[model samples]
Target chain A: MSDFLMFSLVPMTVAIVICMSCALLGNFLVLRRQSLIGDAISHVALPGIVASFLLTGTLASSAMMLGAGVSALFTVAMIELIRRLGRVENSAAMGVVFTSLFALGVLMLEWNEVGTVHLDVEHALYGNLESLIWFEGTSLAALVDPRALSDLPPQLARVAWMGALVVAFVVAFRRSLVLASFDADFAASVGARPTLVGLLLVVMVAVAAIAAFEAVGAIIVIAMFICPAAAARLMTDRLASQVALSQLIAVASAVLGYVLAGYGPGWMGLGVSLSAAGMIATLSGGFLLLACLFGPHRHRREALST
Target chain B: MEAWWRALIFDAGYNTSLVTLGAMLLGGGAGMIGSFVLLRKRSLVSDAISHATLPGLALAFILMALVFGDGRWMPGLLVGAGLSAAVGLWAVQAISHRTRLGEDAAIGAVLSTFFGLGVVLLTVIQSMAVSGQAGLTGYLVGSTAGMLAAEAQLIALCSLLLAAGIFVMRRDFLMVCFDPVFASTNGVRVQRVDMLLMLLLLAVVVIGLRITGLILIVALTIIPPVTGRFWTDRPLRVVALAALLGALAGYLGVTLSSVREGLPTGPLVVLACFVLFLVSFLLSPRRGILATLMAHQRFKRRVHLRQGLLAMARDEAIFDDLTMRVLRRQGFIRRDGVATPSGWAAARDAEHEERLWALYRQYYPEESAQLDHRGLLPIERVLSPDTIMVLENRLMMGRGAHP
Candidate 1:
């Protein structure tokens, strides 16, 4: 029972935290038509994580966070530069820059005498969420004991901070973010610097992405950044309700995905635990599909209303 | 240099050469089909479709294992990829056409969701204890180093079919791209033409998926045509140039990967295409960055010179010395800084343009403020239909102050 709680319950909490944080910020990304930046940033963050390992010789959180921050800023600047200089479309520029960065990360990992270390491209692509166990004080009794709170895994703590940072950022800049997302010129006229607000939002996204990278992997990070928010958007028209709906969906996906990933294989006679990150992403996709077909604002109804 | 030449020609191993040839063919076919896709403004739609193939591929693998007692055939996998990609494209079209979500949102939704589903399937496949299951990861990040000659031959055959199909239907494709409403009115099957192009896109994507991987395969289709666009405007020339660029990227990317020890082949090819794109963006004679900058500078210089001439013609005290020299050199002014006859005529034209600009500023404060004084003069060469109509009405009213 302790093993079950340690393995299943703790990871589910971590997944929920990661999902809610990503989905909250994603609501604005979808509103601003910059949903793909999530995809671009997560892919580009691979080299950041790898570089952090090479520099520190350990997978330290602060170093990796700093690396991810630098890499995200660099990716944004490069995408803008490519778009301006090459006159390429925004999506094409994103595709080119992020893929090159990811390839560079792969090459670096290969050059660094790969298999001796814990990091690998495969791991980065699909994370090892199952390894995030409560090893410090593994007991169901730890849950009720206030002293045992400190025994929480470091990754869980990091995600908790990430969640706090996301909430703080949204609260601090909610008005500016909303105005900038809807009308930049109006935002500017109203003393809300859209560019600064955008930068702050991107910083939060980078933090969230890097924090979740070890727990959820790059693909799930991208999927959470888009699918939950998009599904919520289809369900509502107001931004506030949309954000609420997105968080609800995200938490539900995390819980459902974690349970299914743990138990679904056993039921099917495979006798193997699958990847929680992949299952969460898949479940989020399922939610998006359902929302598209049967949500309050179905496509045809949206069209007619508009 | 000699070694480089040898490798470039025929000295690379048979597998290397075969892979390179296959890449080149795939690139050419994607380039041609991508032209239509780009024209349709569905560049990102192709990305969503490629990602959507993952679920289909996994599904095919499982079904083959369960039903047919075999799961690793190349054709079966590709068939699954193609079917799923078609569904993805159809979803994109349906959502964008039917909903207020717009194309970008629809694309993001479909891309992430389909890929997420695929990732889930992959996890399931990994736990099934199937032998050779690890190879499925190759589709995510392609491994061209281990491409077999038989697979290369298949790529070549499919590429050839794609090329022939596009070649025969070139006219119809062009017509549809240029104006679908007109084509439909002319009794051309526009939808059929569109479906044909989508079919070709699926073919190219499935083959290129092996060579470039799913993550970067869209680049093979998108980058080449955008590069071609910088150098030409003619439809045939754009297609030809795109095909050439794609072939070059394939050849160079493959060679680079072969020479380097651990470099990924797909991204290397994509980088090669990007390098070419950057070159064309900066150096193309007509639409290049350098050309645009030069044109802007030349326009600025002309504006300064004309402003000087106008000042001299008006006898304004703010006239500069360089303006006087340029006006004198052009015989627009005498040595005494007096306007000559030809100078007066030119100055009148310049003054008229200024008046037009002044008039333009009243109506569009922001737009006219952004323009230089001479910006409106170019419009005199080919008057806008609205402007022409306005001028005719003014003339009828006997207000003879022509701009």
Candidate 2:
């Protein structure tokens, strides 16, 4: 029973932590009307991973992160350039740049099969939770650190390091991030550097993406980033309440999804990860629908205020 | 270079490239219709349809597999894509009319949920691995290299039909796009026209899925129209230019990929379209940045020349000497320091000649015998004393009456 608790409950707890952090960070993105940027960055991270592999010949977390961050920044820059040039709409530019980069990454992977790049593709697209289970010894160490301090397993140590980094960053920069997100122009007028705030957000997203890639994969990371925030948006108009609700949604979805996946089938069957991601998306969508139906008419408020 | 050309022209693999081209042409024509979809801001509907079609595809595959014990991928894909498009449009309309959700929000809800359902269905289907399921993943990811001659031919036929439909209803479609209210008031069946346009959009998206895939299909539909906008203002011209641009991008993307082993043609094609848009935005003659800047410069020069002439005219003592030099330089002024006949005539033309006559008519509709004798009075004392005073002050100050 304890083993089951450790296998299921512990993982669920970890997933909630990761997913809630993603949703919390994603709030600013959604509020800023840049919800699709998460999707773009997620796709753009492909070339970064591939380039890192080519340069280092191993998927070291740091190298991959650096590559992803740079690529994501590039994608942002391309979108800005497109807008400044006034040649195409912002969304179209995003589609073009991210898709092209992703295609390039696919081509590169095809050209060179250093080792299991195809499997990495699948992992990047859908995530490999089994691999995360094996490689997440670092998280376990952190969980047990208060009770017992021993030489921790390497994988668990890494997970713990990443988790702590994420938490610390969010807590440290919450106010400024929220301010910049709500009205970037206003933030700039009031002596906040919108660019700096934007960079911090992008870095945060990239870090979360890398961390989640270990568990859920890259393609569905978008679901984690977007779904909870979208759901929260429906439930609350206040930023604080939205953030809190999003985290709640994320954590709940993670726990429920983990349980279903664990008990449903062993192997060669529909697993919990994809189902969980899909469920979260569906549920969040449902919440938004309900909000649209029953929530106070925010559009009326907007019209009156304007 | 010669050997490379030969290899490209003669290789068996080249057949695949040709088939892909054929599919793209068909797809591009469909995309031409789909551009109207994007312009209508119903872009996300295409996405909803793509997602909604998944169940149909799965059902078709399952039915075929159970009955014939064979998986026929193309037939299944077609049936699935067509059904989903129809259902998606219906659902969009139903939600909007029956519910209070705005169009964008409704679209967002339907697209995400349907796509999620498709993902769920796809995961289940993958586990089964029926014989026909081998290349099913490729359908989502898309692989132009696998296209066959028959598929190409079918796509071409669809493209021709779409083109014909568009041609037949060009005027109605244009009216609808510009102002649906006006079209409806004028006795056009706006609803039927809109549905037909959407059907064309659906057909294009589904057929293009063979090359561009579902996720990036919107890009193909949108990019061409946006690029074409930079090149023309007329609707017919815009449509033709967009189609040509799309075709060119398709050809270039495929050709570039053939030169290299690793390039994915879909994104390359999109990138090419983006480049064309950028170039047109910067350099096209009528609406491009360069043209606007040039016009601004020219306007500034004209204003400066007019101001310089006015400044010289205000200073009568220095005017005569500077007038000849300035006039020679400007070409509009004359060699004489005093206002030459041509210079005076040009100045009068530039001033409010129409307003001066209107003022004259207001005060003196018929002959004014007293004012007709010009030399009998001082130039300032001509007609109504107030009007003459105002005109004399403006002429002496060298300020144009209109400005």
Candidate 3:
């Protein structure tokens, strides 16, 4: 039990927080027809972190976060510039920018031998989720002890704040965000700044991605950013309820996925642990698949246009 | 430096030359097929397709290790990658069609989930303690440090087939990508052609995996096609230019990576593609940035010069600095802001043209609306000589009526 407490508890909670923040902002992205921006940002995050490490010569959380944030904004600008100036499609523009930047990141990673510093392509993909153990918090009582709480993995606190920030942003701009997402032209005519809302939403997504990236890796970050919200989208047409359901789905996926990854193999006599981050992503994808098949609103059958 | 030069010209040994040549061919094929993918608005689908190959790769590794005692068979893995990528494309199609989610959403879902499954399987393989798994990671970023003759030949032959297939079906691809509805009406099997094109694209993705890696291959295909767009508007020219650019990038990038000790092949190849894209983006005569800016400047001068001439004809005080400078530069006005002899002649023509326009507008409102703006273009350019004469008579009558 102490082993579980020392190892799994903090990582699992951190995973839940990461999922919450990602799912919260995903509501806006999925509705606005920009789900792939999450993929692009996460892809570019590898480069951003590498560039930051190269510049700052440290892997401090703040530095990495700032680097990722700057790169995310850069990617947005690059995609916009290419699309507008080159007259390319939006998706194609995104593909070009993210892949080029990602290649730059990979080249930098290989050239500089960041391997000793715990930076590699595999780490960027799956992350160090399994090793984010809370050594000081060995027992259940340690959860309440101030010293142990203080010693908890710093990622937990960062992800928690990001979760709050995302929830607050969603609650504050619920109406206009929905208006802009559902019908940008109508929203613009009605005196709302759809572009401004869209920009703010993208910033929130970048922040959430950075917050989750260190814990769950880019793949899970993308899965969290899309799967829960997409599954919830199939369940309900109401945007608010959809957001609520996605949060629930995200939390459930995190807890269940963490448990299954840690203990499922033991129960099956394999006697080896699996990756929590990958398991979480896989479970969330399963949730989405299930929703796609059976969710009440999956077909949108009530629409007369059909 | 001599070694670098030798590598540049592909004077490297037989094995190195084989790899370099294979990479160049693969690049050409990717660009050829990628041009069609871009025209069809399915460029991002390549990213999803590449990422989704992971699960199949891991599964193939497991199967091979279990049966053959070696999981490093390139053919087995490429086949596996192709199958999974096809499944990924199908999933994207189904999700977008069956659910309310857009294609972008489907791409995100399929890629992340499939990669997740691959990662999970990879961890399982790690726990199994498989040997010779180091090369498996090479598929991610690609390495040319150790070249095999068979692998190079396989890549070369596959690329040749891919390019030939594209060459044979070029018209069908162009017709389908440009206008599926039109092609279908003209008796083309739109769906079949689209499927065949996708199969060709899958081959490009699978074969390019060793040279450009799966992740960077998206840029390999997409950047060249976009670069090709900068050069020309003709569809066939765009296709040809893209293939040439891709081949150059691939050939140059592989050679350069071979010159260095630590440099990886995939990223260098992508960077080469990006350089080509950047150069064409800034330098092309028609769609490039410099040309667009030059055209805008030329149009601005015409507007300013025309407006200045009209103001001089009407004796209106011209306060716009651009108009003043334009008029002064063209000798339409003196340094002291008075009209010169040639300036007066030009102003008289302009004044007469303005009157002609006013009469033309009053007589033919519909046609006047269709003309480019109002005053910049001369009346003779748009109307026939008979129409100009009629307009000139109307101008004289209007002046007489007013005077």
Candidate 4:
């Protein structure tokens, strides 16, 4: 039983951490009218992940995160450039840039024969969250022990690091971020460089996305960024509460999704465990639907309040 | 390389030729329909709709498998996809209308949520015991190598209908896209036209699913029209050019993928479109980046040269030899480094213009006025003689300066 608890503990914690951090940043994105940027960055991260693996020939988390960060920034830059030079709408620009980059990533993966047993297109697309195991005993003492600590899943540590970084960024820059989102020109008039704040926000979101890519897959990360945050937006009328509520929703969905993925099929007599990431995405999407349909708050609040 | 060359020339095999032709047909249709979608700024809606089709496709397959013991019928699956896409489109509209969220958020929410549902359905299908389920997976990334001649025929037929439909209502599509309110005032039934366009877009997406897959199929519609916009502004020409570019990209991508054993066709096709877009972005005559930059540089240089001439006119500076040469070459100066008759007239005119601007700036600073650098607009030309007299009187009173 302890072994079972140990096996599921790391994946569950990582899932919750990934969801919570993404949901927190996602509220800002939804408020700023840039929610889709998270989806674009996650899609573009595929190329970054593949390029990192190719260049370093290792799946080291740092290399992957760095590569994904570069790729996400490049994607953002390319989208802006396309919108300017091509005179295309921003959405079309995003569609063109990320799809082509994703395509390029796939081609590179095939050409380099990077589809080894450990890393392949399927793993990149769907992820292998099941293998996020820790050899530590299921106890607080074991967690503190250096040997047991060393045996922990590396993805959990990365998630924790990103979670802390995201939290610090939000706490320090909340006022400026809110000002920028509400009215950038007004923010500028008040001696706040809205452009810098906006850039920092995107960079932070990209960082969180790159960190979560290995554990939850790109698709689920997109879900975490949009669904819970959107649902939270429906539930509340304040930015701080939206952020906190989104994190709560994300944690609940993670817990529910993990349990359902593990045991729901047995209850249905299907005797097959489904993909945990997909289950989490579905559950978060369900939260969004419920919020859309039945959230008690119906009065439209001021736009920036979210 | 030789194999690639052979494939490019249709010497690979009959199957290769058929698949390439099918891809081209699908690309042409998607490109044409995508022009309207891009112009209408509904590209994101199309994205949500396409993603929504995945779950519908899976549901269709599941239902057909359980009911008829055969789920591989292409038409039934497409009908399912179309229905689901319509639902997704309706959801996007409803969300933006019913909630405080903007359209972008609605698009993002619907896109991710529907795609998430599709993923769940996909896993469910994979776990089920069913035959003919293998081909369903190809709808995710698309496999051009697995395309059949029958499917190619369907794509060709759809392309024919798409071309004809676009030809019939090109004017209505144009009017509604540019000015829906004006079109409505003219009794053009804008909503019906939008519905027709939506139907056509759905058809293109359905055909494209077999060629490019769900995730990247929106690219076929978006990239071509955007690329075409670089070349022209005429609606029909843009649509025609987009169709041509789309076909070219489709042909080349399939040729390359056929030559390489492991290359995925859908993304390769998108990459090909992107390369074309990149070329057009850099080199197209009208809206290309290079042309815009050149025009900007030319304007800057002209401004610099004009500033030099203006200073010389005021007797505050003299031209360098290089400046004189350039001015002489452009017939703005003479060979002896002195002003010609026209140049002298221009110099006096420039000096007079400067005084007038200075008078206006000093006296009427409250009313921001812009100077027209291209033309020597004397105050008399822009204002009536009586108004100029009044302005001169006011200026003399206000500034204690003479013009």
User: Tens digits of per-residue lDDT for model 2 on B1-403?
Assistant: 4433543453536555564455457545744675576456565566566655655666666667777777565856687767865776676666555443344434444555555555555555665546867556545545565566677576666666766777677788778888999999999999999888888777777776666556556666766776777777787777777777777766655555555543445655666666776688789887677887898776655554444444444533343444455555666555444565665555544344333433455556664443453222223344567776564465545546445
Q: What is the interface RMSD of each candidate, in Å?
A: 2.4, 4.4, 1.2, 1.8
Clashing pairs in 1: none
Error of 4 at B290 (Å): 0.6
Whichever of 3 and 4 has more TM-score, that candidate is 3
| Native-referenced TM-scores of chain A, all candidate models | 0.94, 0.81, 0.96, 0.93
For each candidate, the alpha-carbon lDDT, in order, equals 0.79, 0.62, 0.87, 0.81
Instruction: Give all candidate RMSDs, comma-separated.
Output: 5.4, 8.8, 1.8, 4.3
Give per-residue lDDT, candidate 2, residue A82.
Answer: 57
What TM-score, over all chains together, does every model reach?
0.84, 0.73, 0.97, 0.89
Give the range where candidate 2 chain B is weakest over 10 consecutive residues by summed lDDT: B373-382
lDDT of 3 by residue, B77-108 (tens): 88888898999889888888899988888889
Higher-DockQ candidate among 2 and 4? 4
Residue runs of model 3 more than 4 Å from their true location after superposition: A300-306
* DockQ scores of the candidates: 0.49, 0.23, 0.75, 0.63
In terms of lDDT, model 1 sits at 0.79
For residues B1-403, write the lDDT of model 1, one tens digit per residue.
5543554785878878788888888888878877777777677667788888998999998888777666667778889998988888888888777655667767777777787678778877876656668657667766676666787788778877887788788788888989999999998899999988887887889888877778778888888887888888898778888888988898887777777555567777777887888798889987788988898877766766678767755768535766677778888878987778998888777765555555556656887567664452555664466864564464445445543
Return the TM-score for candidate 2, rounded to 2 decimals: 0.73
Ranking by TM-score: 3, 4, 1, 2
lDDT of 2 at B179: 94
Summed over model 2, clashes come to 7
- CA error at residue B23 for candidate 4, angstroms: 1.8
